[model samples]
Target: MNQSATRLNTEELNLALNLLRAGELVGIPTETVYGLAADASQPEAVAKIFAAKGRPADHPVIVHIAGVEQLAAWAQNIPDEAYLLAQHFWPGPLTLILERQAHVSDAVTGGQNTVGLRAPAHPITQQLLQHFGGGLAAPSANQFGHVSPTTAAHVRGEFSEEVLQLVLDGGACDVGVESTIVSLVGDKPKLLRPGGVSREAIEAVLGDSLEHHTNQYTAKQRVSGLLDSHYAPRTTLITGQAARLQECIAEKLAQNQKVVLICQEINTKLDIEQFLMPSSPQAYAQQIYATLRQLDLQRFDTLFLALPPNTTEWLAIHDRLARAAHHRY
Candidate 1:
């Protein structure tokens, strides 16, 4: 592992801060995934993130802060639910969408009245935010619509040093997926995106059922990771149940196409290359992106991932896989 991979080095932290102050992009680690970060107050700095990733100007990014105390600087008319969710899930993988304050840049909110905010639990990034004392508008540290980076090495591979100079290596992400996004701007809190935080858990805290609004393209307010074909890999990805995926694998192999499979079980021996994934949802989320990146690098004709159980616990995983897949078998 690199010296800064899992630990915060003072020199590296300072360099990242300096880069952000100078309106440059920095790859900052978060508990969810690595993020391409810039000072949120600087629209020009934030624009570089979109330019480098080829992200759409209309698609909004999340602004990361140190803790709940800084929330008021970016959002106005904050609801009690926002505070409640932040109290319970801040410094973790929950992103709250609220109405933007007047000073909040349109670049951060994608020309909308709403802005997404998260307080990441990564230690190195926490330190960076604390020292910088400002919000960093960051999206996943990878090309737009690609699998997000879960490690510093992955971030480095995504962009040239000129584009993204310093990647503060905080090692592999704990919650390999992005943050759970809940839009509090509406009369009812809507679950905009299923992610690291479970919907059930968030509902339990709110004491009301959340309105399911994942993948709502018609929504006037945009949030991160809500697109139809996001988090995809370069290689063609086909996902389905184990039996169905196996059938597809055989069909592809028969056509003389190279195929790989990642699943929870193996009932029979087949000629296809295979990798076993964790059966548990938490473990699965942590490894899914890295596994996809690994398989994507092998140049396979197709990548087959057996779908896990369709349950509340696996909702986030299913949502991500659905968007990542090129086709469903």
Candidate 2:
């Protein structure tokens, strides 16, 4: 049985901040997704985040601040490139990995010498940070390795009230995905994750080409949401071009296998389990996770998704599905 978490108002938001001050976790809304947040200063509070989400100790979480004013305290040797990117994209969906400050915790950085930081673009979250006056180490508010929740209801569906003390309902996330993470700890910036901030947008500001990380995880590459088999549903998912996916579905039908088709363009007349998605990439990104969650609740044994176009606009969407299907880069 799932216990519904409370939706916070102004009064309740203050109460939620108090809970964080007491070293408790709260599900706070960001433009990306709901995040399980705790005071970044407290190692114990950060540890609870890993405990609640069942997140691996080796994988790092992002530290969210109110602004760049807190950068020197959280990160060291801040690069000129970091400042340029932050000026262009902070208070939006972008994460920067930089050389860890002397005081930053190993628990937050996954025992590494670097940390991920972002100033969220949500009003409630910004207000909370303002009142709290510190950083919050947060990851997506759901079981680790599962599809990320886009709304307060999605969070309630995932965990009971006891597990998540309070939820600040800022409604559904506008971006509906995680932030784009760039690692400035290297000689040049490398794209760790493709997300709301397009690579093209970042490169245009830098006046230099950016290196795209393949996400081949080593022990040292302890980045958030970079595991090979991540963002998966319970059922197997195979994704490719529309024609190829259709042929595969036909082959499965011949074997009398239980399958469901998820696509934007497909044969609607066919008598089979299907979920139609929006053709636009941004709209599709907004609903993709919710679609997978709802479809996974049904009796289908396999989920077949027709691939989106291979373009920069579709990069974030493709990155997500490829990981969901456990496709290596």
Candidate 3:
């Protein structure tokens, strides 16, 4: 990693702000993931994000704001539920979908009537937003449909300095996945994506269970990270239960194929390559992407992860892993 690309000094922050103000992209850190950020008010600047990432134009990017007070600047017809959730989860990882204000650009909303907004908790990003005093249309700072970057170095590795000149180093992301997306557009709030914020926690705040609408064909909206095969690595990835994965390892080794395993327990008898992931959900989320990036660099023929339990606590992890894997049992 280049030493210049990972600094969080006043000079770097001011440079980032200047770059963004000038309609250029800057990699900004959030608790969830590093974002390729552009000033939301600048449609041309926002379009640069899509061009750089090769992201589909229709796939909307979340507009990150400084705080709840700025909500009306991007969205309108706000519901009480939006405030309730934002009050609890703002400065954290929760994105609320609401009717877009007429002035909110289609570039940011993906030509939809609604826009996604969040107030990220990373202090450095918060400071930047405060100084800039505007929304930043930022998606994960990696290639489209690839594993999201979780650190400043990861962002640097994704795009060249010429493409993304400044990356504010806020260290490793605490919540390693994207923000939880809840849509308040229709009659009922829907859980578009489960992520850094758990669905249960969101439901508790609204006192109503959110409708699970992720990856549904009939769905009317397109949001980030919902594509069937996203967050994938260049190397093939397979995911299954412990026994099935162990069987896969055996089958692969039998054919003289090189493989690696990411699991909670290391079966030393197998004798290939293995990484022991954290047993807890939060810890696992924080490390999964960085782990995948690390292993993907080694050129393994295949990578296998022992799927965590299919339970509410692990829903976010399961969602990401499911999308990342080429094959799932």
Candidate 4:
């Protein structure tokens, strides 16, 4: 994997702080996913993040802070709901969207009026943010619209050494998906994206149901993972209706295609390898990305997946797979 030798000690943190302070991007680990972080205050450095990831300029990035106190500095009209949720979920996988502060650069918000902010739970990243004492605009440390990295080695595999010089090695991510994004820009709070935090949990805290983004950006754009087509791999992916999975596999085999089944249903009559995943929400969320990346590494010709039950817990997994199977969408 050619993992960077840079440790997460005082020396490494000092080096990362200097690189970021000088307007350069460094790979930082969070419980959700590894992020390519740059100084949010430096527009040029933030722009470099877009260039490196080949991310669209209009797609917003999350500004990670050291703690809850920095929230007001970047977002405006702070709502009690944000604090309530952050109090319970900060230092975990939750991102709140609020009206962008006037001084905050539109570049960080992808020219949108709102910004996403979070206080990640990883100690290494928390330490880095504390020492830096500034907001860092970071997204998944990988190519735009690709499978996100869950480990330090995965980040190294995503970019060349010259491109990502120092990846803060913090082992595998605990929550393998992005943060749950709840936007408080309008009259009500909306769920732009779901991650480690389940909607039921968030709603329980807010005492109100959240709105859903319909992806109707006909006139304007604002989101991180709402693209109709994203998080795809070079290998083809086929999402089949749960009941009709066998039919889908049969059709694929009939066509002489190599099939890799990534679901619970196992039909021994079928002559293909199957990888079973945990039905439990927490376990599935932690392993989904690493599973996809492993399949991509195996150079599989096709992946046949059955949909998990359409429950609140499986929301984020469904969203990611739907994007991975962008062709069907």
Candidate 5:
């Protein structure tokens, strides 16, 4: 790993902010994942992000703002639901879909009338945005349809030698998964995706019965993570009950298949291969991405994942695991 490519500081922040202001790309840290950030208000800078990620033009970027006050500046007709959600979840992993103000770029919104906006909880990101003095149009700091990068080193792995100017290393992400996406554009509140924030958490803050509509990703929706095959690892991922998954692992080992087992605990002592995550939910969430990234590099033929516990707290982990495994609905 290049030392310069994976580290940044306050001085680097100023330099990166200058690059962003001048319509150049910079990799930024966030609680969710590292993002390839550009000035959201600049069309040219936003286009570079899509080119670097090989992301589709129609796939919208989340405009990250410094604070809640800036929300009204970019988003129009902010609803009561948006306000409540923002008050509770801002500076965290929660992206809200709202109607775009006239001045907001269609490029940032992917030609949609509405745009996705977030106030990330990461201090480095907040400082960079505050210095830049505008929203940043950023997507996950990796190639499109690839596993999102949780660490700055992971971000550098995506680029060739000189494409990326700087990667602001802020260690591993706290929320290994993306933000919970809620759309406030419609009459009723809808969850576009389940993530770090639970639906129950959102309801607790709203203090009313909220209707959740299932808007399956269509060609027209252009929502993030809507693609059927995404968040994948190089190795084939098989998911099932812990016991059954363990059995599968044993069977594969008997056949001398190259297999790696990932779970919260390892009961059966199989010497073939295994990775154990912490038993607690918070610990599990924090380590999920880094674990998978490591296992993916080991040249394993298949990955056996023990299904996490069925509980609200495990929702985000389950979602990311299911996507990585590419299980049929």
Candidate 6:
């Protein structure tokens, strides 16, 4: 973290809230990524988020509220499952999709009748929302389609000296990945995205009868972070089995291509560049984006990645990497 980066206090919080109230952007921390937040009700303020991140206007942003009590204000006809999930995972990283209230701006929902909403569990973020007294539409604080930022320095690196008036530094995010987005507006509990909150966890709270949604790449409910070619590094990425990955890396090296390999275990004695993440899923999820962000800066010819095990625990990480490597198709 930069020593000189403005730290959050009561006074700084007030200043950031003022900016948000005035329809300006403020980088607020969440359990997932630091988000570029703007008042969700203000179409102009929400537009600033898309402009700041260079995000496509078609992609929707998640409306983050202070707590579950405020859900009805932004989302209309809240389902029973929404309340159940909120009771279990509010003040945490789990976004619920429900029909939007008439007042909820179409800009925030990308013109969809349903809106994605969540109450992030970061204290500074909650305080900022409570002080601002409104829902904030926030997307990851980075250039669109790039790796998300997990720390304040990451946010600063993206917006160096660009007059980003306020950033609430809440240290590194705990879940590291984005929220598990479940849509309850349909007939059953439909999952829009796999995130830090695993399906098993949700199933444990709900039951096996809960329906899991697949990534169909549809135009109707185009959510943020679910695009085919997103969360990518500047360099090309290849993901697969370890032995085959080693062979592919060697082939790349034979072609005089500089490469970096990211894996859970550094067992292979490959002379090329390599990095290892913790074997634990939680720790790996926390560091995955940051590692990719760092390696993306090296300007390597390609990124040779080891495929994570085909298990439910690694679903979110795999989903992200798969999207990052979509161009290989």
Please name the candidate that would achieve the greatest TM-score relative to the true structure.
1
lDDT of each residue in 1-329, candidate 6, tens digit only: 22233346868877887888888888888888889889999999899888878888878999999888999998888877788889998988899988999998878988889899999888778877777778999989988888889998888888744536777788888878888888887667777788968888898888755565446354246777777777887778888878887777778899999888888788557988789878888888899888988888898898878877879889888888888783331
lDDT of 3 by residue, 1-329 (tens): 11223335787778888899999999988989999999999999999999999999888999999999999988889999999998998988999999999999999988989999999988888888989899999999999989999998899999988888887888898889899988999999999899989998998989998889768464577888788999999899999997878788888888888899899998777787889999899999999999999999998999999898788989999999999999997
State candidate 5's TM-score.
Answer: 0.91
- Tell me the lDDT of model 1 at 96: 94
How does residue 121 of candidate 4 score in lDDT?
86
Q: What TM-score does candidate 6 get on C-alpha atoms?
A: 0.93
TM-scores for candidates 1 onward, in order: 0.97, 0.93, 0.96, 0.94, 0.91, 0.93
* Model 4, span 25-48: residue lDDT tens: 899989899999999999999999
Task: State the displacement of the C-alpha of residue 167, model 5, in Å, after optimal TM-score superposition.
Answer: 0.8
Worst 10 residues of 3 by lDDT: 1-10
Cα lDDT for residue 300, model 5?
Answer: 90
- Candidate 3 pairs with clashing backbones: none
Worst 10 residues of 1 by lDDT: 1-10
Q: Where is model 5 more than 4 Å wrong at Cα?
A: 1-10, 210-215, 218-220, 246-251, 269-271, 327-329
Show where candidate 4 strays beyond 4 Å: 1-7, 214-221, 327-329
Global local distance difference test of model 4: 0.84
What's the true lDDT of residue 192 in model 6?
76
In model 4, the Cα lDDT at residue 316 comes to 90
Better of 3 and 5 by lDDT: 3
Whichever of 1 and 2 has more lDDT, that candidate is: 1
lDDT of 2 by residue, 45-74 (tens): 999999988998988999999988878889
RMSD (Cα, Å) for all candidates, in order, is: 1.7, 3.6, 2.5, 2.9, 3.4, 2.6
Model 1 spans with C-alpha error above 4 angstroms = 1-7
